[model samples]
Target: MTITIPTGDLVGVLSDVVNFAHPKPDGGVLNCVRLNWDGEYLHATATDRIRAGISTWHKDDEPDDDGQDDLFSNWGGADNPWSILMPLDDAKDVISNYKLGPKEYRVPLTIDLHQGVLKIERSRDTGHSRLVMQIQGVLEEFPDVREILANNDRVKPVTGQLYTAKFLADFAKVRARGPLQLAFAEGLTHITIGKRFVGAIAPLPEDRAAA
Candidate 1:
């Protein structure tokens, strides 16, 4: 199946994922972006075990007259979603190096996922390019990030102590355009931007919070 994502949206989601991805001292899959394309929407998530972020974008609608197979016709339901875990650096390079057309209003990227690899391709009247990136199969699953965000209600006041001030600041910077909410509960810091994106940061240890 071919999945097309706009350049602007692709860049935004990738930037957030890369920013939140944390390196592990033991060297593992924690430093990668988990991309799930469920036919209609593409979900990108990153987590450092301490903090996590999820970004989503919908696929472009096709015209009824276009006699092409529905990109999502074979999309197995959410229960069996197609996903690929890609290294943060490769994802960044693919987006940064994609060339946009001079007359194109929105640059669209086509991604082909097969055999644990993602082949990203972009074409314009001016030129075309393709990038193949290896995918780390679902070995170390990403934390239950959705459940973590869902449990933290945003309407309540934030009470948890700040753990990583720099992380909070960086996350705030990425979603700076919209109103950001910081909520704390059960030793976790929840950050929300508008209604689409949500993140969680683990609070500092009791000793550090007291200090």
Candidate 2:
């Protein structure tokens, strides 16, 4: 059987989760992994979360037993890091230098159960972007995932007299070592300038909550 779908199909699926940052190189093992799902042929999708994108090149829609074949063809010729398994140690270099977009392109997905590995790659005339990851080590499945998807867009507007509040100078605050963790609450929107904390801003016109 052949698996085929429009290129646009992968984009929606790819946006599902892109949480991992690029990998860093270490003498240790590959903690991070790149994963791709192949419908034998239809399309493949993967993400690094902070930013997520999809790719599809010219191909058929037939389901073949050659997932490994796709792997070899795609990953055969590339200037990848020395460690094929250590993604956490080497993911950053791959993302920074891996090149894409300038012309028509296609990438292949590989799933090697025997070797306990997975990889996705795109080859260009000049270079290629490849991520060699793992399988089944991580599971992000949740019951209310639609709620998570809904969170990205369904924010209500902050109502009433809007003002651009600054941190420390006006409100309470805290500091942490992650993104989206330091929030400005108590008003329509929270704006923080540095660790000063507790800065609230008027919500955008669309995000304004009802009075």
* TM-scores for every candidate against the unseen true structure: 0.75, 0.28
Best by lDDT: 1
Please write out the lDDT profile of model 1 over residues 45-83, one tens digit for every residue: 988878888877664433123333334333222333578
Reference-based lDDT, residue 102, model 1: 30
Q: Per model, how many backbone clashes are there?
A: 0, 22
Q: Scored by Cα lDDT, where does model 1 land?
A: 0.64
List the candidate 2 regions with Cα displacement exceeding 4 Å: 1-90, 96-101, 107-116, 120-147, 151-155, 159-211
Q: After superposition, how far is residue 84 of candidate 1 from its true place, in Å?
A: 0.4
lDDT of 2 by residue, 1-211 (tens): 1122221222212221122222342412223433333333221222232222222222342221222223234331222211112243333343333323323123333333333333332334223444443323333321221232334443444334433344222222222212332232332343332321122233334344333
lDDT of each: 0.64, 0.29
Model 1 residue 177 lDDT score:
32
Clashing pairs in 1: none
